[model samples]
Target: MPPRIPVSEAQIDRVVAQFYQRVRAHPALGPVFAGHVADWPVHEEKIGRFWRNALLVQRCYDGNPMQVHRAAGDVKAQHFPVWLSIFDAVLAEELPQHLAQAWSALAHRIGRGLSFGLPQTDDADPVPYLG
Candidate 1:
């Protein structure tokens, strides 16, 4: 196997772009996101900045993601795993193993936090992965 490449801004951009494309096409996620996000290109760039800040310590993102997610009226804790799974697939495909693992770990942490913060619905149970 070849040596693993370090994660970079370019890779982060690629991962975010490709990941959202998959998300937009995903059966469960597509409708949810499409309903909320009016502009794909702008949303994608903001998310890219988010990941770049998270993964590379670039400090480019300033928006409150938790607030944004909370305001997404249809989003629920149940949706997190689907989001994570898609993110995981994207990282696996776009990144070296080491970088993927690192990114995955961070994503899991963020996902769990977001899941925990989501307002509980009477019908929905918190997922074990968030615990």
Candidate 2:
């Protein structure tokens, strides 16, 4: 049998809600998101499902995150660090030590992959492989 996932749907909902709440308040991330996101509730629900699919291994999320982020135009590679930082903070505040750490690692990995696929400007390096 597959190993049981310890996280719950309610926990995923809470984390998504809280994380976006903080992201909306963030200086760098807030503006970028505001440009693309017209309806906060819908966006949050979609993201919540994404996380549920990611962590719980559920096939609830349907959209392609890479395509969405790439289409945003303003989602720079540098944004991943700030995004991951905010996400890590949210995870730390919302979950127990083990869960937070595990989620943070996963988030970072996903962020790295997304950032790597983005087009870089002249000032930015061609390489997106982040440590």
Candidate 3:
């Protein structure tokens, strides 16, 4: 079994809400998200489900984040860093220190995995070997 991540559903929902709020305000990230996300509330709820599944080991979320991002056509590999930065900030703001740190570590690992799947731009360098 996957190790259970210590977090509450409320914390997951709060972090997702705050993170997306920051994302919508971010100049670079906002435009990219705006192009894809039409209804903010629905998107937030789906993300909340994703976090619940990820942290709480629930079977609620049924979406392919990688496929969704890839099909969006504008989700570049470079965007993951900025996205994770925003998420880390939100996690720090909304969660206790220990919880925030733990979640951030997991998030960064997931973000790197997701970023690797994204197509590289001509101007971007090759992704480094992690193994």
Candidate 4:
């Protein structure tokens, strides 16, 4: 395997764009995202900035992701693995092994936080991280 390259904004943009493309096409995830996202281009740019901030510590993202996810209401713990799977696949395709693993770890952490922290309407336990 090649040595891991440092992550860049361009790489972040690529990953976000490709990941969303897959998500928007996925059977389970596509509808969930489409229902919540009214504008794809604008949402994509915001997501790119979010990942850039996360991977590069750029402080470009300021939204409360937890609140946003919670507000989605339809988002359930079951959706997290689907989201992570898509994200992991994109990172692996777009980045070096080390960078993909690093980003995957962060994604898992964030996924877990969102899964467990989001308000639940029912008594079902929060979904555990599958990645």
- Give each model's clash number: 0, 0, 0, 0
Over 4 Å off, model 4: 1-5, 119-131
Write candidate 4's Cα lDDT for 47-99 as tens digits: 98787777677778899998998888888777888899989999999999988
- Global lDDT scores for all candidate models: 0.85, 0.87, 0.87, 0.84
Report the C-alpha lDDT of model 2 over 1-131, residue by residue, as the tens digit.
Answer: 33134788898889899989999999989999999999999999999889888888788899999999998888988899999988888888989989999988889989999999886553556677789
Give residue 66's error in model 2 in angstroms. Answer: 0.6
Against the correct fold, how does model 4 do in TM-score?
A: 0.85
Whichever of 1 and 4 has more TM-score, that candidate is: 1
Candidate 1 residue-wise lDDT, 76-111, digit = tens:
888999999999999999988888988898899999
10 residues in a row with least lDDT, candidate 4: 1-10
Off by over 4 Å in 3: 1-3, 122-131
Off by over 4 Å in 1: 1-6, 120-131
* Candidate 3 clashing pairs, residues 3+ apart or interchain: none
Displacement of the residue 8 alpha carbon in candidate 4, Å: 0.7
TM-score for each candidate, following the candidate numbering: 0.86, 0.88, 0.88, 0.85
Clashing pairs in 4: none
Question: Candidate 1, clashing residue pairs?
Answer: none
107: Cα error in model 4, Å: 0.7
Cα lDDT over the full model 3: 0.87
Model 4 / residue 120 / CA error / Å: 6.3
